[model samples]
Target: METRDFELLIGRNIIEKYRADRHRPAVFALAGLEWDLLDEVWPPTYSPGGELFAGRIPFDRMSSFLEMGCGTGIMSVLAARAGVERVLGLDINPAAVRNTELNARRHAVADRVTARESDLYSAVGPDERFDGIYWNPPFLNAPEDSVDTSIWDETMFDPEYAKLRRFLAEGRELLTPRGKAYLWFGEALGNPALVADLAEETGYDLGVLAKTEMAEIPEALADAFPADLVGGDSEDGEDAAWHLHLLELRPRQA
Candidate 1:
């Protein structure tokens, strides 16, 4: 299946899921923050990773927050509402930024929650730093020019893993001395070796902070990854379920 069609199918699935639960608003509450997600933004249906990430956040204390790829701004809002000093959300998709800003307004955190259009940290100032950074990056590695990039595809597939690696490398620069960065990761995305090497070379230590099993796998995802890496169900039954994890990455000691 072509990437365009695959992404369209995923979009359709999200719409259908939303319709099924139309009676209940797409509102998620965690860490004392309630998020009202827009239907047009990245659907948070199969997004347990977001909740897991939010749960790991330190609610008792305040810190600056930076969320890359902040879809609908829920994470940023959660941080702001949790009393984080300041929060900024960045995304490549303009609609995501708009949705984030709107959500921030609705949540009455507009003063502290700022949303902007950026690919990675391009829009961030060189001197800026944060006490906390959050990312649930596009995990699938897509071939260059293999698919017509759509919002759905762009949110799900990381072409050549270039952006993922770049984030792993450069994100450290924006972290304060006592700051920590969190990334939601999955075993199905790519070779574990690739992630391991990147973490090592980037001078970060990757540690699992939380984990959740994936309940459903979209068809488009299957096509994007090889059979062996697409799902956690292997013949050996050793790893029967794919797990989504919140990874804590801290700078390695020299």
Candidate 2:
């Protein structure tokens, strides 16, 4: 798709909630080039996670970045759009990888952005290190047996804490010196102890950036997700909310 069409496809949805204050087009700074990317509604099939992931990674000065489970490659493309020297996006889905590549081309960042089909870290070489890494694991209120294991399984259905543990084990090698790996997770799975313990064991200093008490069902995704799983007092504050934590993880050697 052309850059204009691609930008129009995703920008529209983002503007509704994100750019309500701004009357002009929603501008996205990509790889040193500021583009009028958000002026229209989003694509028909865009997932709910697109805006959430994009909102987490600030437009900071970073030479290299890696986006794990980059559906549609939006986050990776946005990173490239932010002037990051290199942006690598990995996903297990073929269609997602293809869409990522298409978005990269549409944004004129194909030369700098890469989206590939592989598990986390499997697609890159050992020497490949990134200055910034951003990921939003799949954390919904479901068990492993009840849920299908997708890239988002890290957050949604990690009953045994296997996925988080694996990432902690190898995170050191993937991050460069002074680099930071930002992870968006929630306490809904009832595994904060496990998460903290694994981080401590791996010599990572974990920190929570922000915790939003979001309603289990946002009316948009309510029909798709089971309501029983999200039956909590979101409005009353006593209800269980999916705590979004931006963990700042660093390697032991660093």
Best by TM-score: 1
| Residues 174-236, model 1: lDDT tens digits | 888888788888764444567778888889998878887765564323333345434455778
The per-candidate count of clashes, in order, stands at 0, 15
Off by over 4 Å in 1: 1-34, 59-62, 190-193, 215-232
Task: Write down the lDDT that model 2 would get.
Answer: 0.60
lDDT of 2 by residue, 3-89 (tens): 223323222333333335344434443334343333232221222442354545554758899888776566787788778889998
Model 1 residue 166 CA deviation in Å:
0.6
How do the predictions measure up, each by TM-score?
0.79, 0.69
Write out the backbone clash pairs for model 1: none
Worst 10 residues of 2 by lDDT: 38-47
Give the RMSD in angstroms, all C-alphas superposed, for model 1.
Answer: 4.8
